[model samples]
Target: MSKLEIDFCGVKFRNPTVLASGVLGVTASSLKNVVKNGAGGVTTKSIWLKEHAGHKSPVMFGTDHYFMNAVGLSDAGIEKAEKETFPEYSKGGRPAPIIANIVAGKIADFGKLAERVSKLDPDIIEVNISCPNVEDELGKPFACSVVDAAAVTKLVRSKTKKPVIVKLSPNVSNIGEIAKACAGAGADGFCAINTVGPGMAIDINLRKSILSNRVGGLSGPAIKPVAVRCVYDIYKATGLPIIGTGGILTGEDAIEMMMAGARLVGMGTMVYYREVEGFGKVVSEMEEWCRKNGVKNVEEIVACIS
Candidate 1:
């Protein structure tokens, strides 16, 4: 088999297929299932400093081409993560490489959450300053402002010994600039192109919105091109390792992401569109493509486009 192993900020992903945060990522049991089914890594759903009641239901809607939700970063909080998830995830013989995804309302809160979770020694710490749906409480996403992005990234990095990956928003006007700011703040890597939105769907018959939040992030195949472009731009600007996400439904889509400069490709909606084991199937297809194309080290393809 062609070698698919790639290292991102010192962590080795068995393959580039990672379970993106938010799909089946609430508890250890669910996360373990993805790892067992052959995900290279798994990110937990973004946890806030405290429990958050998210937006009212009718929170999701989807069709053949796209998926949307304003989950509002609803989470069980870090205490549960420390008590329930990480310990269980750490015990098993097949310990999944966990990337602890964290979100915050204040700049200092990012550091506090990182400090607390850093004790668990997760393989990585992903600061989610990019979540669009929580703007009502969190104000504008930190990702939209280079200064705020830097402050959050810097704070989180200062608090964690683990590799720090700053998740960037696709909603920004210049994602590359924000990425560069995060990089300067000592971000070890980036998770480019969080769901694209404030976009929406209509319920029509009810003469109302499909999702209760009215507007939500647009994900699935609809955002893949934008993801590829964001990854490509971030690579050109920062040259940082990246987990390219958004609309990765097939091995070909993942490969496209790699060529656009992703060291790892995140699979969320694909798991929904296919199944949890869909990660393994995607990796297999990637290897098959690599073999046919005479690609040896899969890393050779990263940023091949520019």
Candidate 2:
């Protein structure tokens, strides 16, 4: 465990592996299952201030090479999370940190929801300003603009004492600039390259768009290189710990991101690739890689890029 143990924003984790949001993180039981399967930390689905009715089904469609989803930030909402999910996740005072990933429709909603979700006593609060599916309300993902991104971070910062990590969108031209904006707004950390786009998959057979939303965020191995570059650029700009996400599938992929400056590596589409059990599989491979390389502390690799 020595190789896996690491400190992130003053919190301790049994390993560097974390469960990325929006992939089976809908409830306490779902997240608990992630922990049970061996993730060192877990992030809840991006919950909103109120129940959000998402886009119609066919909200997602994909191939083995990549994944596309327009989940529309659908969640059980903050009230239900506080009453049922958060309490259940923390019921036994578990040491593994639970980060409450929150989203909202308006600038004001960010602060309000952050305050409420922070009160649930999650170890950390993640502000999701990157979801591409919310453009109907937000015009575009907040993470796409420095001004909008900073505003959300500043507002959420004012509302919570817990560490606030801003999740960014890969659709932006320069995610590092957005990371800098969040850091300036007092973000304790950052999560990079939240799904890749507003892409469409057409069904030639049915003569229709594959997803109801027409376009969705692209994830999976297809985005790995881009996510790595985003993490590298952000580390250079902010020097803050990063929950590097996007297209991570193997222990090697996790190590690659760590070397690029991620203190914690997030696993999302990998769950789809390898199933929930992928958590343990990836962790074991990480340890095996460390043993082979004589790397005793995984943290030693963060920002080791030279």
Candidate 1: what lDDT?
A: 0.90
Q: Candidate 1: where is the Cα deviation over 4 Å?
A: none
- Candidate 1 scores a C-alpha RMSD against the true structure in Å of 1.0
- Alpha-carbon lDDT, every model: 0.90, 0.89
For model 1, residues 34-76, the per-residue Cα lDDT tens digits are: 9888899999999888998889988776789999989888898
> Each prediction's Cα RMSD?
1.0, 1.1
Candidate 2 residue-wise lDDT, 1-306, digit = tens: 446998888889999999999888888889999999999999998898888888899887668899999888887688889899988888888648998898887889999998888788888898898888778766887888999999999999999899999998878778788899899999999988798877788999999988888888899999999999999999998899999998899999999999999999998889878999999999999999888888888877778883
How many clashing residue pairs appear in each of the predictions shown? 0, 0
Residue 260 deviation, candidate 1, in Å?
Answer: 0.5
| Candidate 2, poorest ten consecutive residues by summed lDDT | 297-306
- Highest lDDT scorer: 1
